[model samples]
Target chain A: MPFFKITLIRSSIGLPKKTQGVLNALGLRKRMATVFKPVNPSTAGQIMKIKELVAVSEVEAAMTSAEMKALRKPDPGYYIETPGLG
Target chain B: MFGPFRATSPLSGGLLWKIPWRLSSPQKRRQRKRLRLVDNVVATVDAALKRQNMESGRNLVRWKEEMPTEEEMRPKDKYTMFDRKEKKYRKGIHKLPKWTRVSQRINPPGF
Candidate 1:
């Protein structure tokens, strides 16, 4: 099944109440927040409501919450290595 | 009068004995022992290598520079999409500030 990845690129602060509600329903509270929903009439309506503020792309598989968080997190380089043995 | 600077040694005969000076902690003492062993091994290897190099009249510095310089290693014709795009944008927009006539030329209406 196709999954639509909706990312809020712009803020919907001054937009209509219904547009903000659509964004809130999709779990996008702040800018750059991404939410994946299955391609359906309900999701299409939400995307249409906030079309100007979001960038949508369809993907084959949906990523879990942990996987999505890991993708956005940067790696903390450097591990302590003892000379001989710690 | 003696010099202002004095070398303080941990094993000073009478002066050190009078004061309550403790040796390094157990962990620090073990670390010092390991460091001394490594230093001794390095000195021995360095001495042997120095003797060999002296016989051949070649210094260690020459071997260190075996790799080419950065300018030589990197290709002159190397191009990145980001750099090219940035240069094109800069040329097209010039030094004029954004939301100006030049910016309008580069980024037309609704772009």
Candidate 2:
């Protein structure tokens, strides 16, 4: 199933209470917070309500929290060539 | 000056004095070689097994999909409560004139 990747890009400080509630329901509390939800009419309507404060993208699958953290980590450049004598 | 002087003179003569104190020439120290395990076959096999394990481990991680373009996700237009011409800004959206009116939307044109 396809998923919607919703990211809060702008602050909802001065927006209406209804808009803020939509953001809270979408699991977006602070700026740059991202959440994944299945593509459906309800989610689409919610995104339309606060379209000005978020960026939305359609993705194939959702990544777990651990996977996201591992993706962000940098790779170690060198590998062990020879084992030392124990 | 006759007997004792002649006997000691031969002891310090040219042939005997020309010889060196030591006989053999000094030998150079040899460089030490690094230690290597005797089992060459086992080491090469172990290295090959480790490389295969690493290649299989890389396949376990799934690839992520690409994100949408910026133009697709961008807001329609930039709207702010601050009016540059009047030098006044509204504290909240509820304070705006069109907050309660359904006919007049808060968003500007082309939004």
Candidate 3:
């Protein structure tokens, strides 16, 4: 399934109320907030509404909410070595 | 004469003092080189292990902790009690306006 990676680069402030509503509905309330939605007609239409404020890219597969959250998290650098890995 | 005998005495300190220092000089340099090599090896191994752990979806930077099986681990415990307490008590959940820096360090020995 195709996925769309959408990042709100521009702020919704000072934009039209309807445009701001679109951003809020998309879960992009802050600048640089990223949301991933499946590539469907409804999502495509929503992207079109705020195309100027967001950067969108279509990817091969959509990540789950947990996976997206993990992606945004920084990696902790150390790991305990199992007896065999050591 | 007694003066000539004193001047040529074998107990003169100069030769013996310089001999020990000169003998150990080369050995000390070699020992330092060996220590440097060992340190580099350790650093390289650490880097490789860190990369491998990250690729396997584990964080290696934290202190050595017990590796919990997927079934045994409590995911909810990952969030601290303080965070949950704050959420329960706070009336409104507002986003932080900007980044803030907080220092958290435990004093080690002689620190």
Candidate 4:
């Protein structure tokens, strides 16, 4: 099954109550928060409710929260060049 | 920012603080892009759901026919919203509160 990759692009601050509720329901508490939902009527309907607040894309696989976090983590400036001889 | 009427005193008046009535060119460009993005999302979801239904042998036609395709929507639906209080019973979409995050695509049938 495909998944809808949703990223909150716009802030929901001062928006209607229901709009805030929808974003929270989608697990988006801050801007740029990304969540993957299976493509179904329920998810589609939810997206419809907050369509303007997010950027949506369809992907074949859903990444775990940890994976998403890792993607955003910066790399260290240096890596261990030499380990003890085997 | 000045007062809404530029002068709070009852006897005093000047240029009123006015919100631009029309969207600027950049605003219009971004608005159209936003509209198109939403349309793209809807189409993606519809196509995926249709594929899922086909795989499951569930021939549900309601959702398939319900979502309006991008080309099927009129410019009025994309740009203006029906507002009884505004002149001509319509208003620029940017006039809507939280418009950047709110979808106001469909209007009343006769509007």
Going through the candidates in order, their DockQ values are 0.01, 0.01, 0.01, 0.45
Highest-scoring model, lDDT? 4
- Of the true interface contacts, each candidate retains a share of 0.00, 0.00, 0.00, 0.51
Stretches of candidate 4 off by over 4 Å are A73-79, A83-86, B1-15, B54-77
Report lDDT (CA) for all predictions. 0.48, 0.48, 0.48, 0.76
* Model 2 chain B worst lDDT window (10 residues): B27-36
Q: Per-residue lDDT of B1-111 in model 4, one digit per residue for the tens?
A: 385767455436665656677788888778778777877766666677777873311222433355454466686666678999988998888888878766666667787
Candidates' chain A TM-scores: 0.78, 0.86, 0.76, 0.82
Considering only N, C-alpha and C atoms within 3 Å, which residue pairs clash in candidate 1?
Answer: none
Top candidate on TM-score is 4
Off by over 4 Å in 1: A74-86, B1-111
Quote model 3's TM-score.
Answer: 0.38
lDDT of 1 by residue, A16-50 (tens): 68878888899999988888886654555555455
Give the per-residue lDDT digits (tens) of candidate 2, residues A1-86: 66777777778887779988999999999999888886655565566566556666666798776887799889988887898798
Better of 3 and 4 by lDDT: 4
Worst 10 residues of 4 chain B by lDDT: B54-63
